[model samples]
Target: MSKFWSETVKRCVPYVPGEQLNDANIVKLNTNENPYPPSPKVVEAIKVEAERKLNLYPSPTVDQLRTDIAEYYGLSKDNIFVGNGSDEVLAFSFLAFFEAGKPIRFPAVSYSFYPVYCKLFNISYEEVKLNRDFTLPVEAFFQTDGGVIFPNPNAPTSIYLEIDAIKEIVENNPDQVVIIDEAYIDFASESAVSLINTYNNLLVIQTMSKSRSLAGLRIGFALGNSDLIEGLTRIKDSFNSYTLDRLAIAGAEAAIKDTNYYKSTTREIIHTREWITAEMKKRGFHILPSQANFIFVSHYNKQAEELYAALKDRNVLIRHFNKPGIDNYLRVTIGTNKNMELFLNKLDEILA
Candidate 1:
């Protein structure tokens, strides 16, 4: 470690994202990115904005884009907070709501970024263990000392918690902020955003990367009561007034408006996920019931690391975490139908 590094940098353990390969022939599925391209309207809007003004700085508040997202979710602009990405919004939230000494609670196997944020911000946290079935033990989050956060349709396992259970957690923690990272919510049943109006302490963060096919543009937003939104805004403005660029704002506005296009794409991914699940079961894989666009699975006879290496050798990539309690499982993102067929055919060969 460098002697010049601060205490925060010294203690931080950075999150390792999924492997990103540059090979054109690889069937990439390690990251849960949308398989389809963004809507045509998004591209056109970006092109128009690109030609308008290249020299001037973008809007500091990003007002119009916030309005568009608010309208899409039947909320007012005051209830919205926009950032460069969901990760940034989440970072700002950790700084805004959670305290240094108070311990927060989150699912043990949920998104890896939560712990990273806690460490970076010097916040105390407890990892709430999941049930035997890998489902969230909702009551475990009741009355946290600091606050609570976890993904709905929890990551890596792809097990979704119902909105009723989320409401229970929120109601139980009336004094603490409950942040729901709904990065993959478009592929799931329902959103906790509908309950934001009822619960003043709830904040629901979402991204355009998965459902709207805008990972390249990096647009994410949060929905909550006006007070919570103002808190996030304060944290953001303190750091960077212009968190998003003009192109991103334009593209996101177009993306949120093109609801039908994303809905069709989301349906297609869900269909592919179900088909792949059935195929994997036929090949002796034990899979979880997934509500997200990815599936968590394990083989009856093979080690996860061995399977991961074998697939990588064949120009196919999937995620296999080396952590304890889940070393045998793999998280596979739902690709296109053709891509999935190739993956399944390769798995058949491996199993044989």
Candidate 2:
């Protein structure tokens, strides 16, 4: 502990992201990143941007990229706000909306980062436990609070809450802010972007990290009412005027516009998820119904930690959380068919 550290800094427990190994041959399925390469269009866009604008600072507002995303989502420029990543957008949300006087509520087993954000921003929050089936309990959100934030296809569980359930919560709590982190929405059954027009209190945050295959570029955005967007913009302006550089803005715009490529890649991941889940079930693993590109599975007979370690030793890396209620589960990202085959082969040997 450093003596120069502030009280808040001293108490802070930072978010631990999934492992990124230097070993290229590892069959990485820990982080929920796209297994496919970004669209060729994205590569072209980045090259064009880098060649033309090495000396100039990126557009302070990143207007063109925001407009492209807005048009793609059928929202106006005023309804959208862009940031370095969804984590930054979410941090701004916590600062701009969630407050200490009232308690923000989210699923007990949702994104691990939510609690970290709360601590970072000093936002008082409460954890509402998920039901036995690992689904969000919409009725639990009825209590009074500062705001609410939860992933649609909640992390580590890969369970999704239908848009109707979200609307039910929004319609009931018109006074509080409801931020739905839709980082995994592209792989999910549906999106809540359609509900933004009707509910001013609802803000949907998404990232290019997962389905868009632009995690390295670090671009994310939020869609909401103009006022909510304005609040995020204010927070963003105070922090970093040029959060997105020229290459990132250009690449994200190209990715968003390449609807065909995006859809094709996500569809492939979903298909692989289905096959893997079924196969794992046949091998005695209880796989949760996943709407995201990852599957959360637990075997009745095998230990999750043992499986994770065994896979890692074989140059395959999958994620296992050793926390309460989910200690036995492994969250495995859906990779390409070949990667999945390799993983399954390793599993066969390990289980045998």
Candidate 3:
């Protein structure tokens, strides 16, 4: 709207994240954040780093954290690229690999941020519609004009694609880069990272925000061949050299080292998800077989909009997208057992 604004700025349509309410009493589950606190080791390491270096800048290369993450995934530091968050890494990938004239392919109902990024960067993209069951159509992504990127255990729908199908897509798109956003992979069955060594074009991106309980820390990384990592690094260096602070670096390192704690929390979330799915089905909700930490459902007798408003009024928040084809569905994060119980109680009251 401003006269001084450039064409790029004017054309941008920013992504809208979930509402963040600070009320302690509300059972918050709109965003897919970990319900448990981070590991004690992570907190302690962050505290130690905070006291040691308040004046100095964090390592520009972020070598140590990258090494730790690489070790965790059985990859070398050269194959990894750390960023402020997975969103930042994805942005870098968009600039590094995708071209403005060539078109990229992604799921139509996958991460909402893909379209936002494409629009921002002037990148032409093809939105391949998902199958009737909300599962990705593997064949549709083969031989893309530019490249491809999509969340593994896709967002909003919470449906996970098998690794075999992912391999097929990567094999077919041997010429172009295939970026797999694995933000929710910890809660899912398998990771596409296993295919990175076999396929040079595959880039697997992950985040500490979901399963590692570091949403506030904002740590995310990408795993790919050294060449693709170098490309991401070039984009990052052009944008901002010091994307991560000392606290985030230290916290992420500790989080990667403390695998047992995070795994325990992940198991709990999966258990809670199973229980919640059964409970919702008992209430006449048809839910997808979710492999992530959230569930997508639509009630047989209730409207999604009405349910969202009713839950909000009861201080139990969940997500309801007003977009076509999925307007009737709601995406609810799997919170703690207590939080889920409260949500179900509120739902029961509404149903009554």
The lDDT leader among the candidates is 3
Question: Tens digits of per-residue lDDT for model 2 on 1-352?
Answer: 9999998898677999989998889999998889999999999999988889679888888788889999998999999999999988998999999987799899999899998988887889999999999998899997456878899889889999988899998887789999899999999988999999999999999999999988888988999999999999998899988898888888998999999998999999999999998899999999889999899999989999999999999999999887999989999999999999999999999999
Error of 2 at 261 (Å): 0.5
Give candidate 3 regions above 4 Å deviation: none
Model 1 lDDT, full chain set? 0.94
Cα RMSD of all models vs. native, in order, equals: 0.7, 0.8, 0.6
- Give per-model TM-scores: 0.99, 0.99, 0.99
Give the Å error, residue 221, model 2: 0.6
Question: What Cα-based lDDT does every candidate model obtain?
Answer: 0.94, 0.91, 0.94
User: Per-residue lDDT for 1-352 in model 3, tens only?
Assistant: 9999999999999999999999998889899999999999999999999899779988999999999999999999999999998999999999999988889999989899999999999999999999999999999999998999999899889999999999999999989999999999999999998888899999999999999999999998999999999999999999999999999999999999999999999999999999999998999999999999999999998999999999999999999988988999999999999999999999999998
Best of the two (2, 3) by TM-score: 3
